[model samples]
Each structure stands twice: as structure tokens, then as C-alpha cells.
Target chain A: MLTNRRTLLAGAGALAAGRAFAQGTGAPIRIGLLHDLSGPFAGAGSVPLSVGAEIAIELFNERGGVDGRMVQAVAADSQSRAEVAINEAERLVSQERVDVIVGVYSSAHAVPLAQRMQAQGKILWINSAIASAVLKGKHFTHVFRPTVHSDQYGEGSIEFLAEHCERATRIAPTQFKLGIIYEDGPYGVGVATALEENARRVGMPVALKEGYSATAPDLSTLVTKLRRARPDAVLQVGYNPDITLFLRQAKAGGLRTRMLIGHGAGYSQIDRLTETFGAEIDHFCNVDPAATQMLDPSRLTPPARELQQTLLTRYHARTQSNDPPTHASMGFNNTWVFLEHVLKPAVREGGGSIDAMRRAALGVDIPVGGTIQGYGVKFNPPEHEMAGQNGRSVAVVMQFENARSKVVWPTPIAGGPPVMPLPAGSPFALR
Target chain B: MDPFLLEAIVNGILLGGVFALPVLGLNLVFGVVDVVWLCYAELVMVGMYCVWFLYTQAGWPLIAAFAACLPVVAGLGLLLHQLVVRPLLSSPPITQVLATGGVLFILQGGAMLIFGTDFRSLGVEMPPMEVGEIFVSGTKLIAFVAALVGAGLLWTFLKFTYVGTAIRAIARDREVMPLMGVDPRRIYLVASAIGGTLAGLAACLLVVQLDVHPFIGLSFGPITFMICVMGGLGNMLGGFLAAFLMGVIISTGGFWWNTEMSYVVAFACFIVVMFARPRGLFAR
Candidate 1:
């Protein structure tokens, strides 16, 4: 009888607290933008990513923010340091009391931030960190990755290579010798492991697999080895500067292959690559999660095109360049989805409670064509190991044609057919 | 010998020649000033940015940009010596190292702010020179020839010119040279200026082949320092020989394995040689 009375009192106290929160007593919803603003990653990633998130916030406010309550964002720079990211994350949560968190550009920064968000039961929407380990188990339920992981690139490349090689060279997949050169990092290892598995499954011969540090001074030796192997195809996993170095050295060292596929970290930013290498960068290909905003007009829905234009304009305004960094598109899409489908719904119903936000996010199921990237957002089954992964995420292959890059694989979305037999050759040839 | 091995050797030698100029400058500054400029690599980075800005952005001729890089960087070097190096000259060696390290940060950060971290290249392409079975990059060959010419001129100047003679005397003993009517401070500033000019020349050579970014120095810095140490910290000839030896070792190792393993092999060679002769490769 005494226990029943205590339970009744506890329930009444909760109801009173809810009533107070509902009656204009609570503060506006706060979202924290955690990104690397100053370190090594700041240039290629953080600045544009920050702008992408801010654009999303700006767009939301223009539309009368979530359920008539103001949404404020607290921004913190990670300084491209993992330790700094941890400290900044703590400050964002403890002092700022952020309702949601977004933005991470590298696995080094993302891994720790994911753990914290999971522990705190707060949400972290990942934009660019592609390491598969981030979504490995049940521990990452609070982390949602709309961007495709590293493994997807491997599978996508193999699929595209199989078709392109058979159609162009009339060579069976089994006869093709593959060479892999990758940076010795989480991102590279993850993609390489997947590429190896997929290659084995498809009965392709693996001739060489070499790993080098990202900051390696020269790639002449690796290129020489690859030249000796003379593989039908080569897969490179690296960042911007190393990609530039490797390509230049490979050409200078006289290393040639039938096809060179880059698992897009720096390669996806084709404008920068082109500006650095010019016409010499032609015939290179990269596989990444499709950013339909930058794709051919026919591939995008009307709404996506509008959103893309808005994002492009905002990015151009900030960078004073016609080209937008790839990260900016990703940043805008991820943040836009969270605000439109998750935070707004939760705020409308539950006075911006974290639990309510999580529920709303889990229930979100935007169709493939609905998103700006032309891919839907639906979390994988809760029972699966990849429960945090966006199930609709698929990889797309992009190839450099002349100076500009265009999507060339997955026929429905391809801007053009794949450029095969890497050295200058006909579009339709069997050699 | 295998053709591939022969080509690798040739490439290594050429690379060593390119590396020699910057290392030579580093050795000169160390010999005379007794100060290790940790920001030496960053100075090269700034020079590269200047080349990019002058040639690519401002549409200056490549030759003009190359010429401008020298004095511009020499001015920067003099300014640095005046502000940072001279102030802490009498302090402990660690203080000098720390101050130089601060300059490195400033240069790197300042470059990023000014250049915006976008990778810029000169887009200067020259057809590879085919020699027998191997193809040699024309740009690298030019860099090698330029290095040889620069080294020759520097050697000639030191032997023939009065100012250069005084600079050399000061290197022998800064305090003792004062009795010989040489101002050590003026010699130190000249040495720093010469060092900067050499770095600028290296930047012009490298900018053609490599992308220009704030972090470009890091790729060459540690290895250049290693070569300087292995060649004898202050001996110019020793440093050049050590650079070629390191280059050949690195190239051969790279051919046999990967860049990382090649670096390990080069480091191992340096460690062994340093132990065998504490004074360095050309120890008198």
C-alpha cells in the first residue's frame, strides 16, 4: 500500500513537470555543429561542411523553424585533432546542452564522437567519415550514417569493372589481374578488405597489394612495382595531396594500367584534382556515394535540383568559386533530412526530448527519389549489425571526361557510359 | 643489371641532386650560425606558394617568377633572422630550436590563410627525355642540372669572393673571426639570405613537378635533415655525397619494396653510418 502511494506521487510529479515544459517554459531547440575548422582537414572538409550545416539551419529558419520554436546551433571547431574533438564535444553537450549534433569529416574524429553520442543517447548524423566500423554493432544505435561507408566503394567498383571490362575488352572477369595500392589507414584498409573479398568472390586474380603511408614522400617505387605487375586495373585509396603526388609520379615513372580506379577520398573532388593536374588527370575514375546535386539535370527530381541550386549558390557565395566542395553537398543533405524528418517532428510533439527525437528519427523512411542525393534515408533493421547504416545508400561510379567528371555507371543514373581500357581507346571495342 | 634497376638508380641519383641544394643551404646556416633552423622546410613551402602566385595567378613568365622567388625569400630569411634567430642567438640551443619551430607554425599557418589550402601546381609539363631504355622526366633532369650549377657557383663564390671568404672564416670560428675583422652578425645574415635563396631555387624546381600546398615542406624536411646529418652537419661536400647515397638507397629499396620500407632502409643506413663515423661520411 505504501509502494502504490509512492508510485502515484511519482507519476503526478512527472505530469506536473511535463505541464510546465509545455507552457512556454522550455528553451529553444539547440543543435551543435562539431567540425574541424582549423587543422589539416579544415581546408578540404570542415569549412564547407560547416557552411552546409549553417545553410540547412538558415533554410529551416526561413520556413519558420520546427513547430514555431527557434532552433539555435552552437558551432565548435575540432581543429582537426581527435583530442580537441573530444573536449569540444563535452563542452557542446555539458554547457551548450545541445539537443542534436552533426558533422564529422574523418574517422579519427568521428569514432570518439560516435561513442560519446551513443553513451549519452544523443544523435550524431555523420556527413563524411566513411569507415565501416562506425556502424559495426549495436553500440552505435544513436549514430546514423546517411553517407555510404568505405566497403560500398569496393563492391561498386568491382561491379562496374566487371561489366565495363567484359563489354569493352571482351575479357572475362576471371582473366583480369587486379592491383591494389592503398594508404595504410582505417579508410584505406576498410575499402581494401572489401575489394579483396569482392575480387575473390568474382574469381579475379590479385597480382599486387601494397600499402603506403598517406604522407609518403614519393610513389615512384609503388608505381614501378605496379608497372611490373601490369594489372588490368588498379585501385588507389588516398587523400588529396598524395593522390596528386601518386598520379604525377606514376605518369613520370612510366607506370601505365588498363584502368585506374580511385576509391574517392580526394579523387571525388574532381575540380581540385583537375586544377592540380589538368588534362593529365583524364581517364581516372572514383566510386563514391552519389551526390545527385552535382549530377546531370535529368537524374535529379525538381525539388532536388532546387535544393542543389540553393546549396551551390550558398557555397559559391562563401568560397567565391563556381565549384562546391563535395563535403558541402553531403553536409546539406544530412542536416536537411534530420531537420525535416526527425527534429521537427519530435519538437512538434515532445517538447524537444532526446528520446522523442530518437523515436522520430528511427521511424523516418524517405523514399529513394525524395532526397537531394537521390537516395532515400531508412535505417537498417535494428537486429542487424549494420542497423545504424542508411539502408538505401548505394555507390555510384564517376569518371573524368575531358576536364569535368560525370557519373558513368549504374545505367539509370549514369550521365554517360564508362570509359574503359584506361589508355585512349574507343567507347565500343573488343581488344 | 636489370633495366628496371638501372632506371631506379638513375632516378635516385637525379632525385639526390634535386635534394642537395636545400640540404646544402641548411648545412651552410648550421655551419656558420650554429643554429638549426627547424623552419627551413617551411621557408621552402613559402617559396613554392610565391612561385604559384607569381607564375600561375599573376601570369608572370616562369623564368621571371623563378628569379623573383630568390630575393623575396632572401628578404623573408633576413627578417626572420633579425626578429627570431638574432634575439635568441646567445640563449640555449633549445631556445633557438623552439623559436624556429614557432616560425614553422607561423609560416605554415600563414600560408594556409593566404593560399587557402587549395593544391596549386605550375602546370608546366616537359616531355620526358628518352635515354636508351629509360625515360627521364625532363623537369627532374632540369632540376638536377640547376642544382649542379647552383652548387658550383656557391663553391666558386666561397673560394673566390672576398665576402664569401669572410663568411667561410666566420664559419670556422665566429668569435675568432671577429679578431680577423669580420662582423659575425653580418656574415650570419648573409648566410641566412643565401640559405633562403637556395630554398627559393629548390622551390622553383619542385613547383613544376609537385603540387604547392602548405604541407609540401613536410615531405622533404625530415629527409633533408637526415641527409644533412649523415653527410656531416656542416660539411657541404659531405652533405651532397650523403644525399646521393641516401637517394640511391631509397630508390633501390623502393624498387624492391614500398616507399615506407625504402624510408626504413634509408634510415637504417643513416644510423649505421652515423655510428661507424660520428663525424659523418666525409669526416676529416
Candidate 2:
């Protein structure tokens, strides 16, 4: 009862605050642009976050705005905490009174915030929260995740490895030893489940499986276990920090393995890790989403490029520095994707209600250059996944060359082709 | 003693010695002033992170990088003692604990906010100067030697120095110590300063061995606290002995069995010994 009272009072206070912001802006619609502007995840976090909101606003205005009304984004950083994210969500929905809230992230912190968004009855679109359960869960609605889940990379990675790498190049599974060292979080767990299933189905012998507690005094013990396993190619499925630790310890201990590959979610951000660790970094591959190509600015369609160009220009202007074009591009892509496919058409169809917008989103088809990851944005109602099961699988295995990851798989998207038995065949000579 | 037990014993002692390097300052302050310096572990973390940042971020020379780091961590410790511990002397002990804990929290948040939660491993180019296959990294060897020297100097200070005696006097009784013209307050202040310096040095050594974060206090504090307790609280030999014992147990135990269970086994051994002898393994 007390909780109910507090909720009511908080609701009333929020209504008053929203009235103030509405009067100040002379706009009826509100959109919350919540993000993690601080901490470790903040590095890659803002690409899908900070810039995503700006692009949506431009698109909304382009299509005569929702309800012939102007939209304002209530942008704030959640700082990667459930409590902070929840508070930010409430501030966006109740206080700022945004018509929709977007850009909550990284599974460690997004779950509770997602719950709060549902409870608060806010229209929320998640740009880049990685756990598959968010899309798969039954309770999640009014929340649309346009980001790729962890397992999406597994099918792509397994296929790439089976077809291209030395260990799996033949019909027989040769040199098929597998080892996984992951961060032991939900994101790690999701990726691990998919990798294990896919690897087994593809005929790799499981040599060792271990979960390293980040809280472990040091990872020397885990690394030692890894060294002893001597797997053909050890797949280190962890965040950047853990990957850095694994590589450093492996080098220090004189551990040798044929290769090291990252599950799509971790250890991909540091563009110069190979250079940082020297020869010890040896043959490493990261399963990363393709880098945002809109940086070229000339390849995009008119409406999309206009929004993209403005965001790229404004982002540079506002911060006096360029935010990584990838996340900012993804962020913009999420809001604009929804606007281009769902909201604009919904308004055109005179279906301004929430159900109408969702219905429009269901049938929407997106093309390449429509998103930061360059995937077509479409959804089925029951699944609500950006890429439903049996979706397109694309994992580019990028190798370190003179310290930077040079894409070397998928032949087409991977700038170079994989010539196997690895450094045995000079990978750095541009394929 | 069995040769294996003797081996275990020796290994434990060395490991504890390394563990004590980081938290020696905490023992000094509490031994003299009855203030449990909780921020001691965080000091080590900041030192580790500073080492990572200086070498990796600033691209400073290894020697110059450490020189820059030591003063920084020491300065941070001194600032903490001044801003937090000093202001709460008259308050209740709980208040003092809360204030120091707050300082720990703030340092942790500040580290996260500034440097980020990334694990920075410099892979600091240190060749393992071998000792007949019991190889040691160059940086770890330097750190181990420094821990011994630092602890020796501290042992001498507490045993022979005038301020050290006054600090001991303050530990016995605050009011009586002042009657002899020794201010208990000054003793506390000096104790904190010395503690900060030692803590700073510990941080420098740890950065060479492990990845650092604002949460590094989490790594060192509990381990060191257990070391201090296992060595018998307030007994430097006890603290020092227990730290190495815990270290060896964690290392060897982790090496042989599950790494997570190593802390459990070490703590269990410490507890059994504490029960059999109500003090520590080497009770004062």
C-alpha cells in the first residue's frame, strides 16, 4: 500500500515536470535517450547510444512528426547500473514524458532497467542490449530490441571456421580441439551455449571448458589449465579486460596455441591489442559486427544519409571530437529504422495508436545500409527478434596485421581471404 | 616435519610475505591507533592502475612511470587520511569506520570514473630470470625483494624509533600517553602517513603482477585482513607470516585443485589453527 502511494505521488510529480518541459519546448511528444556515458563499457557503448537519439529526432521531423506534434529527446547516461538505468527510465517516461525511450544496454545492467520500463508503461526501444533472453522473454513488450543477440555470432563463427580455417578445412574434423574461457556473465553464458552446441554439431572435439571468475586473485591458474589443454584454437569468450588479461598471462607463461578466436561479443574493441602485446598476440580472431561504412557518407540513400550526415556533422561539432561512427551510427539507425519503417507508415495509415505502430514494425523490411550493422531491420510479432531464428549468419574473422584487425573471412565482406595453416602462409600480406 | 609439509610451510611464508606487502600500512595504523584502515587495499589498486596508465597511456619510461606513480598513490593516501580519517577522530568508532569506508568507496568510484574498468596488462617486458626452472618474472622478483626491505625498515621503526614507541603507547591508552607529553593525535597522524607510504609501495609492486581497477581494494583488503588476523592481530610477524602462508596456499592449492576453493582451504586452515590455539598460527 505504501509502495502504491509512493508510486502515485511520484507519478503526480512526474506529470508536473513533464508539463514544464512541454511548455518550454512547445512540443507534445517526448523520447528518452538514455545511455552509459561513463565507465568501461562506455567506450563502445555510446555508438548505439548517444548518437542514435539525434538521428531519430531528425527522421521524426522529416515525416511531419507524430500526431503533427514535435518530439524532444530526454538524453541522460544510465552509467551502466540497473538502479541508475531504472531511475533514468522513469525520468524519461514520467518526468520528461517521452513518447518512447531508447538506447539501454549491455546485459550486466540492462535487465532491471528493462523491467522498470515495462512496469512504468513506457514505449521503449532497445538499441544494443546483447542477451538473447530479452528478445525471447514473454513479458517483454513495449520494448523492441533491434540489436543482434550473442548466439547470432555462434552459427556464423562455426560456419566460418568449418569452411576456412586449417583445423576444419577438410571433410573430416581434423585438429578439432576446442577450449572456451568466458567472463561467466549472462552474455558469456549465452555465447557459450551457442558456441558449444554449434561446435559439437560441426564435429570439434571439446578439449576443455572453464569459467574464470573475474574476482579470481589472478588468472594464472585458468591460463595454466588452458596451456595444458593445448587446444587447436582456443576461443576466449570474454569482455575486453578479461581478453587482455588472458593474452598477457598466456604470453608471460609461455603458453602456445595454434589460434585464439573471440565470440562476437568480447575482446574486439581494442583495435591495437596485437601491437600492444607483440608476437605473443600471434594468431587471434575477433567475431565483430562489420564496422559502420556510413563514414563514407556517399553510399547511403537520401533520407538516411541526410540524417546520418547531420548526426556525423553535429556529433563532431558538439563534442569537438568524433564519437566512433559505429555506435552513434547504430543508435541513429535504431530510432530512424523504427521511424522509417514503423512510425512514419503508422501515421500515414492514420494508425497513431501503440498497437498500430507495433503492427507496422511487424511487416517492415529493412535493406543493407539501413542499420549500423548493415542488416535489414524486420520483425515477427511472436519472436520480436531483430533477426529471428534461421536468420542470416555473418561472422567476419578479422586477424591482427601490424597490430590492427584485418578482416580475412567470408571472402566478400572480409576484405581478404583466409589462407590456412595460418601465419604459415603470410596472412598480413593482404590475403 | 615432513619434507612436503616443510615445503608447504616455506612456500606459505613466502606467499604471505608478498600478500603483506600491500596491507602492511593497515596493520600499522590499527596497531597504534585502533583505526582499521580499510582503504589500504584500494591504495594498492590505485598503484597498480597508475602503473598501467603511465606505461600504456602516457608512454612514460618504466622507471619514470613508477616514479610518477609512487608519489601519486602516496599523495592520494595522505589526502585521504587528512580529508577523512582526521575529521572523524572525535566521532564514534562506527562513524570512523563509515568515514574511512566512504573514502574507500570514493577512491574506487573515482578510479572507475577516470581510468575505466578495463583490465590493463602492460605485459611489462620483464624476462623470467630463472632459478633452476623455478623461474620468476623480473618485476615480481623486484617486488618480492622490495616487500622484504620495506617490512624490515618498518620492523626496525616500530622496535627502535621514538615515534614508534609513542604510537605503541597510544595503542595502550590514549589519555595516559598524552600525560608523558606525547600527543595521541600526532601519533595517529604519523602512523597514517607511514601507513600511506608503505601502502603506496605495495601498490607499485602489485601493478607488476596483476591487472588493476578501482575495485582492487576488493582483491587485497580481505586477503590482507585474513593475513593480519592469521598472524595474530597487532603482531607484525604474525601478519607477515600469515600473508605468505595464505599466498602459498592460494597459489599451490589453486594450482593443484579448484582455484575458488583455495581461498576456502587457506581460510579453513587459519580457522582450525585459531580454534586449536585461540590466537593465530604464531600468536603473540
TM-score of chain B of each: 0.98, 0.86
TM-score of each: 0.90, 0.80
Q: Highest lDDT: which candidate? A: 1
The candidate 1 chain A region of ten consecutive residues with least summed lDDT is A1-10
Poorest lDDT segment (10 consecutive residues) of candidate 2 chain A:
A1-10
lDDT of 1: 0.78
**What overall lDDT goes with each candidate model?**
0.78, 0.62
Predicted complex 1: DockQ: 0.27
Highest DockQ among the candidates is held by which one?
A: 1
Say what the interface RMSD of candidate 1 is.
Answer: 14.6
**Residue lDDT tens for model 1, A364-399:** 898776777778888875577887788887778878
Candidate 1 lDDT, tens digit per residue, B45-120?
Answer: 8898888899978999989999999998888888889999998999999999999999998998787666665667
